[model samples]
Target: MSTQIITAKWIVTGTSRDGDIQMLDDAAIAFDDGVILAVGPRAQVITAYPDAKVTPHPLHLIMPGLINAHHHVGLTPLQLGAPDSPLELWFAARLAIRKVDPYLDTLYSAFEMISSGVTTVQHIQGWAMGDLEAVVGSASSVMDAYADIGMRASYSYGVREQNRFVYEDDAAFCDRLPPETAKKMAAHLHRLTMPFNDFLTLFDRLTDTKTSPRARVQLAPANLHWMSDDGLLALQEKSVAAGVPMHMHLLETAYQKEYAARRTGTTAVRHLEKLGLLGPHMTLGHGVWMTEEDIEICAGTGTCICHNCSSNLRLRSGTLPLMPLLDRGMTVGMGIDEAGINDDRDMLQELRMVLNLHRVPGMDPAEVPSAGDVLRMATEHGARTTPFGPRIGRLDPGCRMDAVVLDYDSATYPYQDTDIAPMVALIHRAKSKDVHSVLIEGDVVYHDGRFTRVDRDAVLARIAEALAKPRDADELNRHALREAVFPTVRAFYDGYLQTTADRDPFYKGSSRH
Candidate 1:
């Protein structure tokens, strides 16, 4: 195996313990194949491995690559014409916009995500492709796209099969279809949990064959409110059977909480518990409305929660009690949640947002959430939210050789020995442009601003053209998508009659849903 060494001014490895934690000035790392063979002071490593290729990262800060614990990479196109109002209003708009594929959406989102120092993403794709088989097939094709780009992805073919709005499932609109379309779709979705299924299967296989292990694979149950009782139960069963972590949006808003409570006569978390779904295998997203009891349940079940700071803030969903969650001993990861909200895909900035959002009046920023806490959320804590944990987060010898080097000239540069140096420059000053290089599973995928494997510009142009293609929605769909879909969706929520006083203790006079 060939060896390479990267020397930097500071190596602020996101670590807690002093020994394994690396912060070497004038340090050099020796790498063979795709793994970090050794790390120490520059002269020590270089003198020890005379034959190793030496590359100076040149006045840059070396750190672990960023992980986006939550994503719907191709779903950004769904936001194009989404409604003007909050939550439900936007859901209607999102539903209309989803029909447009353009294929470019996935490439565009991926490029943006990679450029921002995010080497890994937990991906969920396509709500409209309800038939299980079609979902698996389409997702397989998308995985092919990711492999070419050298992304370490935890991908799942999202299966949210519910018989609801016409826009949600439009098999009837297909003018011509194979007689076995229904059977095909069902078989495909079911096989999603079967061995080597959908996107996850392809990713897992690639890593296993790894002449060197290359990528990460994770399974997601999509989100709660989107799935039916049976579907949710199946996801839990399937996830446990596969020994993979389950991802889902737990409680993002009052509407979801109330809706689930009414249907199940209990909170969503409790309902899952009754179904024997609560366990270490589950990783939930959001949890904005989780009751104290729910938080306790999460702690007991050993479930990790990924907080998508930008999406929640973008949709005006209230800020989460991060300090409280930390106090409760629940692991938390950070996420961007596609569509470039928080405005961009920069995880460092998102981490900074996590810090600032949790630190408010009277609450001392130091006490509420330190920079170290946010940094951990982006790495170790973030990894827990996916199937691959400790293996990828740290810079230990055996950990995946995935890390990012931040340029010292960036706005967040000149990190001092203070507690905030790592967090401030990381969260505040750093942007994708400041990223000097990125390595995932022992390979450099992003060198400077260019992706090493994929042609970013060509992929982007194709995406722009395809995104523009989906807006027209054809015939019964095209006309209905533009004019009737939003109102119909809005009508479903608006027409929902409330029979009882909201059980929520924090219920306000007005309903945001």
Candidate 2:
């Protein structure tokens, strides 16, 4: 295929050798057959590739596409009637959410993500209910949605072997409830249960039958409390054998920390390290309550972390010690989780939130995140946590040509001081509406407020029509069970952490206090 060159007023190529943001002014990128061939000054590129067809965006800033390193579900929980609550109680409340068609639901978020310059997402499918075949079918729909929309996705079926509800055995927890509620809970758990081997089969099936090059399946251990020790070890082995990475949720809340102590008499990180599950291939999601020692373990093991700032705040999970993680030179990716603070999946807004949220007390400039650091989290660092890895993160030679073009004029409308750096200005001023175009695999999938593949409005309308129907008997029953057992679920964690001194306060009071 002939080379295509895209020129922009400014280009953020990637990070430099010194770990700073790399930028090229009046630059152009030349690609052929979906791989970058060269990125340099516009005049140099034009002279070198004189015959290449050039597309010029003199007022745009082209940058590597943003990656949502951690994501789950399509419709926000609030839209599905699950109000923000503590992480433990939120699971119960989510059981009542109205069912949505997996394809349309996935598309709903894909549209939002693409509009905000997110080109890839690490979609961890969790809480899937039904037999193996049915679960596989739902997973297929999710993958198909991304393929149809021309967005890359790293998908994983969460391997949850135990503790489907509370951080206890399913049978044991059900036995403690009222007889009727016990029966209902047992039935509900039964639907979600599949043999451990079936999870392996599901992984093999997805691995062997991937429909699109844009989609790759990985493994997720779900959470520390959600999996047994044996299951986690087996998963680690499977991940190594298959050459795929694993994203596991760990220590998102103080209660989870307490649960880990109660279960293993140690921190979750130490327990995982003992089981040989901590490594570069492993990404721990929401390390909100990680202790200093836990951080050290992760840092030593080269384990990645996906920081879900909005989810942590929304679920009342404590803020992650992001500054310390960065200080340790650990790789951290950005994730919006179920939804961002505005109940939408907007990566740009999420980046801004992450940039400002960790500004702790005292005036240590080194403690605060710079625009380059936040961008790295959303782009290259986020990419590390996914199966796509380095291939799709940077706009460098040998990397996949996945990028976003922002209308610099629109982003800094009225006037922007010339002295202000482009990267800093875009981070603070850019909105989703300023996204001018998006390219994936050298193809323009979105441009000038339109998607090249699939009808977003039509898909959204179908979703609205599907959910407009009245609740069915099965739906009503689930809602009733959720209501009947919410208090019980909440009570399960009452004082659960009160007795544990292992818990660390998110903030320490001043000496005067």
Candidate 3:
């Protein structure tokens, strides 16, 4: 295999020991055939491999590419008129948006991720629509987009067997609504129903493929409240039988915690354990409401958590007890759910947000997550939630050569600090514009403000044109129905909460409190 050596002014190898990242100055890395061959001081590597082609960067910081552990369809709910409301009502707003081609939608987000130094993503496909063939085609479109862009992705469509909306049955919810409004709601929501056999069959067909190094298919049972006991078990069975990872949303909202108590008379985590669904192969997304007992269960079972800091905050969901989770040595990954504070899919900014969000009001230095911890969460630990795991997170020998090059001129040039840690500086200052290039498997897919593989401008223009079209009759009706159901859904949660005197012990109300 032909060899290439890339030398940078600073290389932050995301290999942690004890509690610090292993970093090198004036470092050079050699790779061949998409695998890292060696990483060390510049002079030694250059001297050892004199014949390897050398690419020198005198002002760059090289680090592992970021990983998005929990993601969904690229289109942000907020952009689609879903305001900053409770997640339950937010769901209604999302249902009101116009439909776009899945391929274009996936590619649109991939472009943002690639430009912002993200090399991998876990796309939790929520619910597949249309007939069986159409459903499979939609999934294929998403996977094909990832392959075309050369970004590694773990894709799974979440299955919901019951409770599509509200905590009760569909007929009951419809019965409560006015006849005309009920008609619209049922017509829109009823199509979500699909046989369990059909769901698994589609997943099986999508996963049965000649595996690409860039993509893998997994299984997801939408959420703890959305699935029946039988549905969860069937998902567990299928995940085990197919030998793929399982990722599900667990306790994302306070209402969900209530649902767990009301339905199963216990915490959702314990309920999953009872159903034999908690295991090393499972990853729980947005575990913002997990209690101490739930944490213990997760720690014991080796189930992982993906920290989507931006999503939790945006949806007004409580923050995950990140420090405690890290202290227990539970694996946690970072993600920018739908959008970040800037309403964009920028991982670099998300990294900074993750660092700041968890630093509670305490003088204990240990309470704050350091830059290394944040980096690992965005890279190696994040990999655990997907099929990639340790293979693509580090820059050590034998690992896949997935990395990002930051122009130090843009990140830390005018007043370079030799005393401050590289990652600390990066967390505070780095932005997507600082990304010089992003590489996956040693191929430079994004370089110097341009994507090497696809016509970015054309793709973006097509997305704009598609979204700009007038809403169809169904889309228009969805908007009307969402408004009609929004208040009822809010009332449902209010009444449900009144049934119990339990208050969220973890989340202190916002400053307004």
List, residue by residue over 415-513, the lDDT tens digit for candidate 1.
444555543555677777888888877788888788888888887676566656534423235334445435544655663435323454422334579
lDDT of 3 by residue, 248-365 (tens): 9888888888888889888899999999999879999889888888998999999999898988898888789888788888888888877877777899888888898877776888
| lDDT agreement with native, every candidate | 0.66, 0.91, 0.85
Cα TM-score per model: 0.83, 0.98, 0.96
Off by over 4 Å in 1: 17-22, 98-103, 128-133, 163-213, 363-367, 412-423, 466-476, 495-513
Clashes of each: 10, 0, 0
Q: Please, what are the lDDT tens digits per residue for candidate 2 over residues 151-268? A: 9999998988899999899999898789999999999999999999999999999889888888899999999888998999899999999999999999998898889988999889
Q: Candidate 3: which pairs clash?
A: none
Please rank every candidate by TM-score, starting with the best: 2, 3, 1
In Å, residue 218's CA in model 3 sits off its true spot by 0.7
Worst 10-residue lDDT window for candidate 2 reads 501-510
Global lDDT for candidate 2?
0.91
Candidate 1 vs 3: which has more TM-score:
3
Q: What's the residue-level lDDT of 203 in candidate 1?
A: 35
Ranked candidates, highest lDDT first: 2, 3, 1
